[model samples]
Target: MLKQTANMQSSNWIGHFIKITAALTAVFILCETVLYLTNPNNRWTLVANTSLKDGISNSLVYPAYAVDVAFQDVEEYPLTEPLIVNPLPNIINDVVLPQNDTFLPVHLVRFYFGLPHGDSHSFCWIDCISILSIMLYVKPSKIYIHTNYPDYWPFGRCDMITDWSLIQLVYTRQRFHLSGRRITFYKHEADVTKYSVAYQYGGIVQDSDVFHLPKMVELLRDWKNKKYQCLLTREDHFMNSGFIACPKGHPYTHDVLLRYRDDYRDPPVLYNSADVPWEIYNKNKDYQKNFFVDYQMGNHSWDYKGPIRYKEIPAWHAYWHGCDENEKNTVQLAKNSTYWEMLHFILAEGRKALIAVFPTTVKP
Candidate 1:
């Protein structure tokens, strides 16, 4: 009787073991399938190998996905060959050109925003207005928003934007974190991303808080004509990285990237984005002459009660500074302010008209 009971117990144990193994195997297969479907590299490969038209269609279907997936892959796997510098064509003197004429080569405007703590994905009124200003004034071929979280769309005031075709989201990893430190600053990560994007793709890198003006068009033309390696703006006594424009494979941007990679120090030291560029400016005397630096780019005063500089209003920062966090209040302020009329004029009469009939002072 004892031998029979032992035999039954052994059979039950073996059956349970087999069932557990099968369950684990099924789980593993399911996980692998999910990974294969969602992996960015695999998706990028499938899209990149397709025809150009099909690739564009696929990107349009998912606007928030990384449009520069191939670039991201290249970064992951370092290229052995030297980086190529494609010379940009000069802009024609006349603004209006023939239908077949290509004005510039793929002007890419980039903005970087990081969502570290998984906080709100919604953009503030200031951000919305700033982007709207860029779309209206800069007339970029494409605007890429590089962020750690690519799934940040459909939140906040994005509905306010009418056109979604030109905008894209790119996934980027944070580069400025200490090995064992728990603290990370979003500002540093943004700095690194902007420099990297400018070096890799060659275009304008703008801060979310800064507004674009018609004057920027002229600066871009100068960049192309003079063959300036990079463009920066001066705010007060120091150079501000709020706005940076460069062509791909420029040594200026590459130097900034190298500085970040090698000399990046944790917070409290505070010298990465604007400071590094300023340092480069001081070190290289010729850089000052070669790189275009405009004083009017970031001239907006921080104090809400301070006088508003009419001339510097185009590339102003923090237009909604002093307004309540409520969106309605912001909208009302805009309607009551000269900015409303200014925007209307730009949209209706066009940027050229606005520049021709420049206003000295605007009343709220």
Candidate 2:
């Protein structure tokens, strides 16, 4: 009887232990699920069922990641999603063309076509974006682009595109021949930075991948001639390097070159080399090398900087450039259809606004 009683007690204890372990596992899973849902950029809907409004609150925790995930989804799957972007009118249906008497703002355009034969792929997209941006956001005097294929520009849409402005050190007859890799990626971008310094035009230079938003010109106008050399915007989670505003010839462009040269000499010494995070970019030697390191003196200026001012107008915008199989599939799909339409819709609206706002007193 005693042996039988001991056996029963042991069995009860084992059962209790199993039950506790199972309960703990269930709690852990539930907590993890809740955490994931709270992240705005997690794309929980892609994996589980969730509404965007509910996701918005969760987005506060992982704001950058949440935004990136949300934008990526919107950019890729715009067709399935609603066309209602709050606060901004839909351009496709309500395009506002310029009236008979009004002129447009002095246009400012720049291009980034670093990839060779990238003109057809990257540069072509940039030209379209530039035209669309000029039409929608601000009136540019002329959009200047730096590419090997200037012949491919849509001259019908643009008024004119003059010759290249900056000195071409890499492609010059004998100045300094760049390796194929540099030509493929960094050469044209470096040239654009130089051009921004050399040209006195107040327009910003941008990479081909940028997508413009409404009120972009107003933002630039607000920052004109204050002593800050360069201005940039934020993207989903980090600062977008593209879309910088400066006079035709800003002095800091030279600083950019010096930093680039130093970076080349010591790969780990500069900001965000071809491969690294912003943490590396901020603390690197290049930051010190820059002439405009003083924030008070107004050397480094950006629309969004630091943790406090994170929600201002995005200075550097991010598009659906995806990584991984799932993300790539979604990104490519949206790039084909929904992305262009929404972008064009925004552009059309902006053009009308530009026409209404363009300076009538200035000469064409």
Candidate 3:
């Protein structure tokens, strides 16, 4: 009887061990499947983390707010080593076709803000820092700033930026049928219009909040020589609309505008401004050939390997919800050594740094 009882006990233990092993195996497979289905080309996807140490990109971040997946299996362009870029300055409104070495000849750096006055303006010093950074690095022949409050901050200060002027940028708002209702968002308007405006005008369309670095000068200059028609980047899983550059009359830029217009021509909008441009480009073979991998040009600069060329809102523009957390992040990044170094330290330390300095109830 004792021997029989011991035999039964050993069998039960073995069964439990097999069950646990199978469960763990299934979990591992599920995690890999999720990663495979989400990223393009099965390459690295930018997952948000506090630091660069460890393989965070490969790990499942499983962010509560982040579940949106886009354009799976699409091959992404690769960014070769940085070359010495030179922005061939074209005469504003009179772009000269290069007789010999006319690559990406664009001299106008354009920025637009709908409301520049009253409490609704929402332009803060952090915003100013980004714009100032762009102006200092890009070194464009002419800077065209379009704002409702032409008399406000950056308009009259031509001396502040290298070259500055005001242009009347007006757009008739269009309604989109999204989430079972007609909606009009400023970002949506900026999305389609940016392509249209940039195509005709011939320049770089930059957001007011896009921070620039000195290293970007050479990269942009080299891009001109490479015959790249347009350079766009991804913010997380979607192609970002906040920053884009194109020489005058680039076909890719024109096609993107047409696609966006056609998609919303009727009803039931599928993609947002950021996703729309990417979808259009992904279908085109020619555009892919001229593409470049730009880690720094993206909304999240610290995710990839490069100098932090641009500064953007971490998750979304509305992530902070006016709770002062955004400002805290901005302030934190501004301190210490180079912006890159400061950002690296903050990301590595994660919530601890936030708690130490700007102790908040908010949890990362």
Candidate 4:
């Protein structure tokens, strides 16, 4: 009778322990999900659902994986052929072509990479939205996406994207040719490539994160008539490398490239790109006229930390509130938010007026 009672007690204890373990596991998962959803950076990982892979070259380069992730249940969305360029030509040694006298060639350049943990397959909705903004506003002749992995094209959300012909994937070498030099940080690599591409192509180089505005078109048109070799924007007191427009063989861009090639070392200098331009601008006061630094252009509230003085809603609020764990819910929220409003404005009257009007002072 005692043995039976002990057995019953042991069984009851085991059941209780199992229940407690499961409860803890559930709580942990809930916490993880909440954290991931709240963080904007994690949205790409959530949407892609891709296994993180090391070394971009080792991964298989195919559109099938992208299509599967981007268009899983949508039957109406048809597959489209993506334009890709394998083994991008070495333009480093090539002579800088003469500037296009009529207008800055409508070529737009952007660099995309999944570095630190190279997952070439990962792309977010914001990336697509940014591209769409550029397409709608700037209407570039060609949009070059310089990437380490050439095979991986972001076609997952092609249904939302309009022009496939505008996008061309150019494969860039992981190492620089100066004594076979390699950049330790991917950000530096982007800095070097931006100048190189601008030097070679003689167009606009914009960061992938920035959304192009309608006024940008007018600004570019105005730049063509001016004598400035490059047009740069100011973020706070320093010059930002985010948006740059210059002609082919511009001396300013060439100088920036030389700085990176000669001065850049293993322990990377933080903000080397931004600093180079800022220093150059200050040192050569006479040459300042050659570079147009617009204080108002590209300035937005996203990076601003000041109190809410303006009626315009902060971009962070729009993005964060609109994001959700469910892809459809996220999409729907984005459509209803200020982001969609801006896109619509760009589409409707972007050619005639500015989509975003920023107050001169957001600082407290």
Q: Which candidate has the highest TM-score of all?
A: 1
* Best-to-worst TM-score order: 1, 4, 3, 2
Task: Give the alpha carbon lDDT tens digit for every residue of 1-364 in model 3.
Answer: 9999999999999999999999999999998788655533233324322221232222342321111111111112222212111111211224333423333222212323333444344444344434445444564544454322234454332222222332222322222332223444445544554554455455566665555554556667766676565667675656777667766556666566555534543233326466666776788888788875354355454333334323332211111112232334655555543443533333334345335545665354
Global lDDT for candidate 1?
Answer: 0.54
lDDT scores for all predictions? Answer: 0.54, 0.36, 0.45, 0.51
Candidate 4 positional error at 78, Å = 48
Estimate TM-scores for all models. Answer: 0.59, 0.39, 0.48, 0.56
Residue 132 of model 1 has an lDDT of 66
lDDT string, candidate 1, 159-214, tens digits: 34555676766555443243223226666555666666666666678777676666
- Candidate 1, 219: how far from true, in Å? 2.3
Q: Which whole-number lDDT from 0 to 100 does residue 250 have in model 1?
A: 65
Kindly list the per-residue Cα lDDT of model 4 for residues 1-364, writing each as its tens digit: 9999999999999999999999999999998789656533233321222211221122232321111111111112222311111122342233222434553333333344432222334345555556666676666766777665555665464334544777776655433322234455656656656766665566777665556665666666666677566778765656666677776546566566566645655454445677777787788865586777876544555544334211232111211211122234445644555555454443344333333322242211
Q: What is the alpha-carbon lDDT for the whole of candidate 4?
A: 0.51
Clashing pairs in 3: 50-347, 50-348, 51-347, 85-218, 85-221, 85-222, 86-221, 86-222, 87-221
- Model 1 ranges with Cα > 4 A deviation: 1-120, 154-156, 176-183, 299-301, 310-314, 319-328, 331-364
Expressed as tens digits, the lDDT of each residue in 187-220 for candidate 2 is 3334423332222233555554445555455554
After TM-score superposition, what is the CA distance of residue 96 in candidate 2 from its true location, in Å?
34
lDDT of 2: 0.36
